[model samples]
Target: VEPKITLTDKELQAEISELCKYAALLDDSQLEVQVKDGVAVLNGRVASSYQKSYADLLAYRAGAKEVDSRGINVHWRHTNPLLRAQRYEKVTDEDIQAAIQRAFKHDPRLLSFEPQVKVEHGVVTLTGDVGHLTAQQAAEQDALHTIGVQRVKNNLRVRWPDEPASDEQIADYTRAAMTRDPYVERHNLNIECENAHVSLYGVVDTQFEKYHAEWIASRQKGVVHVNDYLAVRTKWKPKSDAAIEADLKDKLAYAFVDPDNQVTAKVENGVAILQGTVDTWYMWQTALDQAIAAGAREPHCLIEVRYGLPSGPHYYGPHDYVPR
Candidate 1:
């Protein structure tokens, strides 16, 4: 078990700032941190919402009980112009590829696997074999979230070590895992396994729980793929479509400093549909997150990315990146 972090507020503020500085994506963010009690507040401008997420993660790692990152703004054009050209410090495809390899080395799930990496422009491709499905997914996530990476092509194959477990054994193990997990244990989930493919069928309270169930199912040995069919149960009373849309718009405006209101939210039959254009994947993701927080369960995002660079081929869809 990891030791409990008990840093003082002042020390935690410094620690978070230092940690942010060490991250490649946050190097140019110039973020400022303020800590009071156990809450850490971050204020600065970041190029992408991914960088803001990384900064928040660092704050929590530095012992902050609650992270207030709303003060930090996401500017699609926040990078230093000189650093991209005159300073000769722009991140290259080779740099991104190397960073991903280092990330894999640091990741406990990927330390034992050496997946082949190839980069072109800002796109990365991972092609190799891993002993489990989790490692394969981790490889893709690491590459996809890396700074300067626009998209990831995960062609990595998952090959189980030794003999693959029988479908019955796989289901038993997955069901046991769900029982052991605190998030989905009491949710009365149903699991089925066929040819090493795990299927999760149940209702979770939130998207986090739904994803957590799928995550646990995928970790089982001999599991090749997880088909997540878990539905999110709406705990709150149903609201009218207009009410939901109004709530979504209010949440988005509060979450972002979008003067032009690049993203729009609409509701149809109690479901929220987000439509608009944003400059980067992070903005698009933040819109979805805000929609869910505004009581739009399983919202459909129809937002388009307006980044100048050409997007990678649609591996899962037409979007630049798929939210895990």
Candidate 2:
């Protein structure tokens, strides 16, 4: 049996305040923290959604039973020069195609498959068959990160070299893969296979684990498509909307390595709404993954990809590096 820990309300409040003061993302000078009956209420404004959410997590870590952050408002700042430059510079169709090819060449997973790329104005259409779903996603990401790409139409299909395995075989492979994956192995997931498609039905703590399960299943040798019906299991001791939102914001900020990416999250009635801009499709997907991890039941992702921009803090030539 686990031992129960207790703290007085005054002690809890002091600890929460100290935690907030030392938090790297939060501006302690602008915010105020109050505690009552182990619940912490945060007031004031933050520069980004990331900071607001991070502050809430600090409160929880400091032994607050609950956190309220509705008083905090998000005031975002526009700092990216590339976003400003887009209004003046016009990227041609040829440049978009070249950029897409460069992105494909840079990604080790997509290096083997030469998907045909076509560009019309700023719209890119990719049509080819890859070994698996991850490669197909990589191809679409290639188009999404290309400069001047206004939209991506990924018609890439999965084409495996080996003979199609039976549903039982696919299920076996999926189970083995899930067992091997560190993120997914801890959960008691239910796996179902039909034809080449696999379905996952289970409850996990975070959105990352839910998507990670799907990613693992999608990579199985015979998997053509994955149907994820996995749910995020709420903890026995539930957190307030403010706490969940704050947790989500920190998760998203950490999940996407690029500091320039501006993503924000809001939670209401267990639903999380995300809005902002990222440099690549991977980061966009990662933002959604973080939302799910934060225990949002229905995460509405409104994030957009601004391709052909630097993905990280440092320069890595002209093309964005493919996340391994």
Candidate 3:
């Protein structure tokens, strides 16, 4: 057997301290780090959930074998001058409508559907017919991301062509689409179709695969709606919690653009709990994807966005955004 390499407590604490110094989300003055037998324990008060998570990730990356983050408390309000002065601006209804139209016009997936948008007191109502359910959902997502929009009412209808595909044909086409897509092809998925509505049942390794399967079904020739009942099943591997945490940290650190922004992750039984703050909403999403790709079955996100900054969280409506 090969000799096991381990970090001394002093070395581990020093490494974690250095990571926290570079993390944009963590408040070093309020944090206390401790390590024993390669396990790191973080004690501190963070302004947001994102900071709490970042602290955990920093410790793991610094060579801690296991992380205990129970000592970190998340305080919703921040005392930072920048965060305190952030104001919510009210956007006009006409602006919201214009933004929605622009979003639809720009996205090729939604260009075919000319959905009527109406906004009253920040609530947007979409009324139109589209060729596919995905298009209808895309329109709703556009409205939600518009500034000052509070809620969305998606009244859009999916109008199947006169020569709609049969249920059997729809199912077959959906399976073919999934198989063609390299990301979703390897998983064993069961597809069932009724009245052009597809239902998927299976176990995949990541959330990306689960949702990709649905997207494939929705884009099929005659799919009405996709019902996803898929589950995430991580392949069993003998990995220490510390090893998994370090791997996740490396992935996020390399991909993340903002050195100031910090994100932390904890793993238990294949589940990753992510917490911290990111500079932008796009970064927030990227972090989640990286975590899932690093073998996290289900990642619990407590990441917070510092609004009012140049790189802050963007508003997302009920339906998630679908890129063309």
lDDT of 1 by residue, 94-213 (tens): 777777776675566886788999999888889989988889998888776566777899999888868888777887788788888888787665455666777665456789999888
Ranking by lDDT: 1, 2, 3
- By TM-score, the candidates rank as 1, 2, 3
Assess each prediction's global lDDT (C-alpha) against the native: 0.72, 0.69, 0.68
Q: Please, what are the lDDT tens digits per residue for candidate 3 over residues 1-324?
A: 322225689977876765553333442225778988878898877788877886776576555678898988778654454432231133467766766675575456786679999989878999979999889878887667555577999999888777888777887788788889999787655566776777775556688888888888888887778878666655656666677778899997888657678888889876677778765444655666676568765566566655322111232322121111
lDDT of 3 at 133: 82
Each prediction's total of clashing residue pairs, residues at least 3 apart in sequence or on different chains, is 0, 4, 6
- Residue-level lDDT of model 2, residues 233-293, one tens digit each, is 5553455789889899888767766678888889887777888888754465566667667
What TM-score does structure 2 among the candidates reach? 0.49
In model 2, the worst 10-residue window by lDDT is 315-324
In terms of lDDT, the best-performing candidate is 1
